[model samples]
Target chain A: MHSEKELIDGCAKGDRAAQRAFYERYCGRMMALCNRYAKSTQEAEDILQEGFIKIFGSIASFRKEAKLTTWMTRIMINTALNMQRQKLYLLPMVDVNDANLYEQEEIGLSDFHFTELIRMVQSLPDGCRIIFNLFAIEGYGHKEIADMLNISEGTSKSQYNRAKSLLQAKLKAEQKYENVRGQKL
Target chain B: MKTSEDRNFEEEWKSALDGAEMAPSDHVWNSIDLKISHAEQGEMKKRVLFYQRVAAASILFALCLGAAGWFWNYEDASVKSLASQTVGENQKESASSIAKVPFSNQNSSNSSAVTITESQNANSIKSAVGNYENGVKTRIENGGKNHALASEASNGSDIAAMIAPADKNVLTLGKEAELESRRTSQSNTGFENGSVTELATNGLSMSAIRLTGKPVEQIESARTFKIAKKEQSPTDDQNRNWWASVNGSGGAYNQSSSSNSVATSLFQQSATSTFYAAPNSKEVGVGTSFSYGMSMGKKVANRWVVMGGVNYLNQSIDYQTNIVLQDASQSKAFLADLASLSSNLASTNPYVLRNTNEFISVPLQAGYLLLNRKAGVQLNAGVAADIFYRNTMTDLSGQFGSFSQAAGDNSVYRNLNWTGLLGTELSYKMNRHYQVSLMPGFRYSFNSVLKSSTGSTINPLVWDVGFRLKYVF
Candidate 1:
């Protein structure tokens, strides 16, 4: 396998094999980042393809000051945000009561499949889904999420809380259904 | 902003999706590869177009240079031939007038009327021209019967008195007339002493023949005599002491020093850093220079001439730097906010910048003629005050286009510079009025063209060969 610097140099020089290798190395992880922000698998794939194209085109300008993964992750996040920016402009975010912020509990997610967890996150409202992913999963502060989406900090906080409560209620219902099935069996 | 309860909930979700990976559809990579291929082709096409434009510009400049030289030579030849033809026609008229004098004495005086306009100091010279005219008219009217009567009117001593005046304002015979008079004196019998002897001797002979008791109709056939007067002086030639010229030159220019100023450091900054980094290496190469202008000069002394003119000068320096080329609009950001820039700000491709500086130069020069002849040589020395106009930074590789900045209060270039000049000119006189010269010159700037605030030094030295076409006014 070629080293990261050699692969980057080759891709910058338009080496097709190096470009393919670069894509293959990072596509899976980038696809997962894209999926968290996208509403569907098809939209997630679209974001991943566009993000990789940007990465390749601007590769000559990359100075390698940041870690390769960190730089690529930033590009993926920017691309996903751009794809969802238009919908975010049209859809108004729901403002729940602040009581939802204090009602959080320690929940066990070890039994949930990663795909099922992604589906639960994606199933939230467009504004709530993006805020919850940015705040809970990506560890971005609510103020930073507000600035990125051009929304207020209060709106970001209320939306994340609503999304968390919705996910907890769904997980509890699923656990109850599984227990019922086990009893019947 | 995260509370303890919220932290645990976020931690559980974050760990659950921490290493999530999914396989995208196969078509995504194929589409990206195709788009990148098309982009590479587009870049190649753009580069080809840039080279084509540069080639076309070079060809046009060559054609213009060739056409200017051809036109100058062609014009000189045509004008010289026309001047020779006019001199020949004037001689023929003087000869025909001499042969016709015996038939009409009154008409002879009219034909030979010399309009003498002397300087204010020599106002009495007009009467001298009148006395010479009356002497010839009296001899033609008397129809000379004896050699003594003919000698009295055509006396060589009297003609000498008219020529050697106190103010020297009398008519001076042209070179052609002096040569013709010598031929007549060698062949004829009498009157061989003064400037006008040739025409007087011919007139007397024609008058004596016509008065030989022949009938009117018989003498009419013998009245084929002609007389011509061609009076010219070298001192009175128009624009003999004042001349005007247009000149053009091409040369190589060299910079004797380099600058490590704040401006250069700003431009040499690395692509990713907020603060500009020092250049890894610096190379300053010699570049081409060109100038063209017109000047007016006057002969101040016997062998000295002085001139002053405005010239447009273009000087260039080839600068190769590793600094990533950026848009000029980001200049304000260079000093204001380094953190505002993203990590992807810099490019790895290095480019050459041709620094082209333009100036309007006013030169005052004095020349001493070393060999003043048909082919003359002169030595000249001068100083020029060059007013800065603009400096253009061109990326020769065409990866980025060129930009220009005029000299202003905040500009790096100074508003004015001084240069010392020395040269020798080898010139050839094309005619009485036109001269063509080749001048090879050396020039050196007296001070740096850049402002002291920039902490840059650029003292350029140039060696140029110029072509000058001068016309006496």
Candidate 2:
């Protein structure tokens, strides 16, 4: 079965060493999860500490019905969600009250690297960046984007288009600048 | 004109972002560390305050419990001073007029829950709490007494034979500890026959009484004192410090189930035989500590902390006005100000006073450190005083808030107050620098606010779950 199950069984025998081993195995991965959902790295770390506490404290409950990582991920998500609510963070909604405002414009790719597109997506302003991420990379509709960002579906569609157009222009400008620099060199 | 192929090439451009190349600033670790430290400190302060209350309860339990047939208190000053000296350690001592048959608190980690109080007119000095505690040494001693009581229940059966060499059944610590004790030393007042409830209410001058029919080989009651080592053997008094505190004491509320009465008695017996076994070997250290930890996770353990260096463990309850206003009017105004949203003016203001509130609190706790480490978590309880720290308010501005005041100075605050710590860290060694931690658990406070300044009041009872960390060096 799962490695955690064996470790847990060992711990049930009052094996302090096993318990310590268990803690070390998950601390890093949990910290990574904390980093994603936290407003600041510290806040995420705080969530990590709290999460591990619950983990070790409640280790007896871990019957190994699911993978250890899965169980830990759930705790991490819950902690992050709680922090988000407590800190009044800007979290994207999953569902939508509005419909998709913009249809995806198919810009066929021949030689474009996926990383360039991702960077372009990342470079957008907060509102636009989120909208593009939800629409382009995540494949969410405008309505879903609006719900998550707490904005109008129209705003989502407009922002997505604006992001795409801005990205296209930036790339073209960068390409021209590079060619000029190459000639001079 | 550009060809269709050229146009296609020009329009489509993409590059995959490598995870490592786009790494954020490395100093992010420091930033994360700062917040984590801040939150951890606040949480630690809260927990220690809670532990202090429980310690108080445990001390009180040691007094109220007559299960061991001990003369609860003696009417003498020197003895009372001894008990009162442990006041800083615990705040929940009561005066019972019961006899001091071999005193057994089911929760005593220390063999004898001996304490010397220094209260102004210390009654229980020689009576009950006397010869036992220091202000800071009071709580842990009592908690240890109670802990010993519980532990005795589990292991007493094993140690009973150790008490008397003739008997194979080493006197189980907590088992059958009913030594005949009486509170009828004075006239014919409180005691109906030989039975009395408390030793001396607040008057700790209760005397010791035991019917030693068990045939002791000696005349004077056997009392054992464990001597310190050649090195600076950190007395409980020397242990209390500002920077670090080790709080293993949880709570002293349940007197009947107190492990001290059993454990302390057994340990006392065992301690008497210390010449055979090393005191250092049986010694489990009590540490006092001060530390700051940042909660390093948002999902499970989100926190931030900052270090405050101070030696005083006094608890005061002060109110803070926290204002939580949901302003739909402001939102509408902003929307109106944005000329673009004028046409779609159907949206109304979402801001209306949702929750205008106030909180009441009494924060209680006592703190001290050993070798610069805060002490708590094992001995299992402590004592503290509490007051109010108000944080909720609805002022003249018609705004809702968790804390805010239009009249006088208003702000939301976490004033250290009184609380009862229930469970403690079951000893977990972390990094070399920080070894102190707790088994996650809950704390209950008689008062609401955990802390307070001068004249402020608020209700504050928070059920917090986080680790208490400390630096050993």
Looking only at chain B, model 1 earns a TM-score of 0.46
Worst 10 residues of 1 chain B by lDDT: B142-151
lDDT of 2 by residue, B1-473 (tens): 33464334333421132121222333433333333334333454566567655544544443344222234222223333432342222233422111112324443333432221222222222234434332211111111111111112122222222222232221111211222322234333312222111122222322221222121222222222211111332322322222243332221111011112222332345432221111110121111222122321111111111222212221212111121223444322111111121232232112211112122322222222111223333323343333223322222112222223221233323344455543323334443445555533344445533123322232323222234555543
Off by over 4 Å in 2: A1-119, A180-185, B1-21, B33-44, B58-473
DockQ of 1: 0.33
* RMSD of each candidate relative to the true structure: 22.7, 26.9
lDDT (C-alpha, whole model) for all candidates: 0.61, 0.35
How much is the lDDT of residue B86 in candidate 2?
27
